[model samples]
Target: MKKSIKISLGGLAFNIEEDAYAILEEYIESLIMHLGNTPEAKDIVGDIEARASELFIDLLSGMQTITIDMVSSVIEILGRPEQIVNGGESNGQSDKKSEEPKSTERRRLYRDGENGIIAGVASGLGIYFNIDSIVFRILFGVLLFANGLGAIVYIVMWIAVPIAVTTRQRMEMRGENINFSNLEKNVKEEFNKVKQNMEKRNVSGFFQKFFNTVGQILIAIGRVFGVIAKVIVVILAVVFISIGLIGLLATTASIFFGSTIVSLFPTFSGVTLAELIGSTFDLGSTLWIVIPLFFVLAIPLLALVFLGLRMVFRFKMRDTVVFVSVATIWIIAVTLLAFVLFFQARSFTIRETVRDKTELILESAQTSTIRLVANANILEGVDIPQKFFNLDDYSIANNNGKPMIMGKPSFFIGKSTSDSFELLILKRSRGATSQLARRSANGLSLLFELQDNSLVVDPFFTLSQGDKWRAQDVEVTLLLPEGKRVYIDRSMEPILSANQTCCMSWPDELVGRIWEMRGNKLVEIR
Candidate 1:
């Protein structure tokens, strides 16, 4: 039989055999010294005692018998003198305090913590959990980071947990003995009044009214400012987004239309590459613009009117009228601006000047001498057969040493011009250099100068979104059927001749040879 001795460990009333109680107290005290006399370690010791009780009961096997050796046995099973300890977590709450925010956080000090940069509650926490202070600090730092909220929360914690000045206060902060005698049987219970008081978060009486009023005012002001700020931010964001969209639309139009779009719409007459580039495609049209305008202008005014009505039914319409008047003015201004923009985009087109040209000539000769003057070497020394002007599209004209007496016969046509003409005669293909005749064409125009060089783009071709075609006049001497002279004008005769369009041929031996009326004599360009 085990006789019970009345003793208290850390203020917890315990009835155990004399030897068991002494050993238990000694063991718990040792734990406290090691755990910095914190409330958490005290809690762990209590758990150890309870566990020992159960172990002791199991050993007895149905008799209400207990033994100190049984408690020692439980201690050994738990591990070494240091290892004989467990964390201060209570029944079924091992992960709760670590994971979730406690209904009451572990503040720096007792009574909701005061004057401590660190959570004194955490220190007391070390006592309650019987964990190391360093462990708690690391754990807190990690939790703070993992939460993803900024460091403001940690600062809040620093402010909330109290500092422990006195030894008793420190103990209380740890949920330990407020009075040394009451330390054990759950010190958390002893601080119930303080905890409840902390729950209400009652600060000094002097601060109470002042803070309450200040907080209320601040909240009201903040709400109003927040409303305005949110509105502005949304407005700005919408504008930015719209601008980007409009720009994209313009660029897409510019690429596809090129000069064509400006050619079609007269409303968009002034539109250019710059206009296309500058226009923002942001379509805040119809509902997007109108709905927002209604709300922005109406909400505040309605609220004011409602408040005024409630205050005095003597509801003078003057202020409401004033607001409406101002809003109307703004609306009119904006609408006018929109109308102006709409009107500006009317009708448009794109037309411009072009000057590059090429001409081919075939002439009649009286002698058998190879007359490859203009066409002689005209097609040489120039970039031709370009993709822009498919040389395959160019028509071949043959001018043998005979006039129109032989219908398209007597000499083969094989030659080609640029700024100056070079004509050659084509005969049976010997596949040698001697097969081609020289001096095959005569100079046809004054400014043209027997040019065989392929047409180069006019350097000063002016491009515009307009349409106009001016006609040019050219002088020509023609060979008629009666061997007489004939003058031609495009205005008078749209077609120079049904079969012959002022024909010329290889009638000269040198390049740039011009024909004169000095009894049908041809001369070379000086």
Candidate 2:
């Protein structure tokens, strides 16, 4: 319950206890009396008061009142007024230096600008942790691979850490005594460091003049190239922003309105664009997939746009809060997207194939030629146009029951070991396991009928309902006996395998032509 008084020192106000105020006031009077009433003396006194005010502020921290102990500590740090002789150290300073106790002030973190290469962060950390700066430098270099985390941390530290400028500050930074002895030693060390740096830079030989000329020329060239580099950077930034914006807009549109837009066209029937995209990869619910995907696409785009704007405007963001928040979110989004992709990848790990072979029934046993015709009525209920159907690998179709995935089957001709003609339908699909793959492959249905010697095959094969797409494919191989002739209908041109027509200049040339199987190869009868 001590009384407190309000006072102003060095234009900074303070609420100090009565005892501390009396001590501080007497100390100021002693400083004024020691150095007479000169302008230089006044300036020195003002500086001392300013330093005392700062010490008081640091001691107070959250407290509102300065105590006698705090005043004593400040006086000790600044030194007693009797120690000054002609505004400098007195001869008695050395005699009393031995009686002064060592300063127990904890080391304060400050950037060591004098011994630093780049902003002094690593050197400051080295001083604080009592380790070599090279270790921190190496750690930062290694962490640069972790999404440039080192650069971010370095920039934040550089912004937040203050450089040690004053002798007292440097002393506190090293946890050294703050008395006159240590202050004087710190000043000498600073002077020696500057002298050494100057000595290294100062050269008086003819080589110095030559090197100076070369340096000047290099600097001049650098200025010219710097402008060009800036222009190139601006151009690149513009390109990045444009690409980011376009990609972001396109992704948003695809997620929300893609199904509506695709419905206008006659490309896919009985399914929306979202369903088609979902069919490609199975990732739980649509929301779970969309949220992570949106962030993964949009965050990078937004970051690119922000970077470009920053570059163009030449503005700086000192507060790292916004940057840190955005970076954290971006990292989370990337991790989630990676997880979703990994989970979906498991669905296609195993591949299984199912095959079916049926003997072709001919009405006439004496018929020597088989005419292969394409059935156009296979897609009777499906509303997709022929041009659109030809372009797609798989599409959804109404199969009079539920919408089913259908794809065109590839056709090839092979030599049969038996005299009778044979047809093989090989269905291939992928799944998470061999069993699931087999199930998916077995669900495929291929339609074909033989009337007399003429064979009609559907161009498309379908997957049963409730089965998702897993790279389902169907191959139709006709095993023909040697010397058996077959005629290909023009409608079958779309389903013919490219390998069978590689020798022909045009794939459609195989249509409407009679081909004879000779020695496991189909030879065109021109």
Candidate 3:
């Protein structure tokens, strides 16, 4: 049996037969002696060793150890030490003499990190297809104006393509054969290009210097903008994360704690949080509304935070995984929200209105006046705090252990067909069916009373207990005789009708103003 030994090549461990190891060592020593002890020589040797290790591993496949035959094959492919030393001149002469076709190796797609602007995709594509990188960059920029499709495509390509890091990878990207001669030629070409650029800059005249200065200024400006962009992203991440966390916590508490905490806080519309949610959705459908709600808000915020971290720290992540996960979650959340809203809208399809009229008899008196005022006793009895929650449009209160909905009441003045004074109350509500709508409309508990010459009207109307709010509203019409006069109170401003056109802009400004009914309009009397 041949003696086997452990060897490390290009930082990779391998098991090789003693004879194979000796051959490989001798081949590498000859390359070192021919190339001389320079940094370039060291790099060349490392690349050759790495390439050889790759080839050996490929050839051994299922073998337990590398043999001398494998090592000899790898060295032959790399070429002799004398050939490598004079390959640049001899290969060119030999190709011309033999009239042989050039290598037809296929090019590979890889991100050219050495000559890239962003993620190296454009540069890599340029090298692979034998085109200018600026053309691809400009094309991508133009596509960005076509509804941002270019940006999406670029991100996908950046994530999918691998970066050309090793010398072999770079050679493959340029369709060059992975051999020592091509590698040396490529390295020398890069070194010469850099040297020429430096020499040109050193010899640059006035215009060249001016252009270089302008380029430097632009680069500085770009760096400043990059910093600003990172700052903006960080700020947005903080704001989004804060809002998402708060919304998620609130939703969780409402779901587990049964809205007990939510009820304690009053909404901007003077409605309890529980009352507003209960009005819009049923308890059974709350999950569909709440769960997707969290993902819709939270996922984007989490993604923003991740992006901000990447920008600030210049760290890399599994971008494909993060992007796909976030996109999927956002789509599902939006779909669920749409579905819940669509079904909930069906609850307000039909409207029904209920009307009640009552006649008032007054003793014969000259200059009879009707004063409109709000009933404070009823509001006090309901135990509703007088503190306004900017809810002039609607309000909710607890009445005898039941939920009550209140809405603004509007009034209109009209001439009586008969000589008697009448008051009409119209209550309106909506439901899935007309019957249900009518029942809901008839369930209101609004009150109005006429004491002496003063007419006390509730500024707001209330719905019955356990009724979901379906855009409930009330309108009060006062049918007055031609000779009767009326006075409006300032407290009733919230419930004033919007159809008035008596040169008065504000309803509250018309308070304490006396008006007499003529044919159809109420004419102001000084």
Candidate 1 stretches with Cα past 4 Å from truth are: 1-195, 198-206, 266-526
Cα lDDT tens digits, model 2, 151-256, are 8787667656777877666776787756433454455566677779897875557865674565456546656777898999899889989988998988887776
lDDT of 1 by residue, 1-526 (tens): 6578765433333456767766766766765675576555555565555545545545656433345876576555433344313433343455534542222323233422332223343444565465665676666678768884434444444444444544345544554312222233234454464578788874556555664465456556656876897676666555544554565455456544535764575334323332222221123343334334344444444544454343333332325565687677667656755664454332111212222223334243331122222122333332231211111212111122101100111211222223212222211111112211111111111122322322111111111111111111122222222222222112212212223222343322222333222233332223
TM-score top scorer = 3
Worst 10 residues of 2 by lDDT: 382-391
Looking at model 2, residue 83 earns an lDDT score of 59
Off by over 4 Å in 2: 1-220, 263-273, 282-284, 376-380, 384-404, 417-419, 498-510, 518-523
**Ranking of all predicted structures according to lDDT, beginning with the best and ending with the worst:** 2, 3, 1
Residue-level lDDT tens digits of model 3 in 229-315: 878877776665666567657556654454455356543223344445665575564567767776776676566556555655666
Indicate the worst ten consecutive residues by lDDT in candidate 1.
401-410
- Model 3 / residue 270 / CA error / Å: 8.4
- Model 2 lDDT, full chain set: 0.76
Task: Give the clashing pairs for model 3.
Answer: none
Q: What is the lDDT of residue 439 in candidate 2?
A: 95
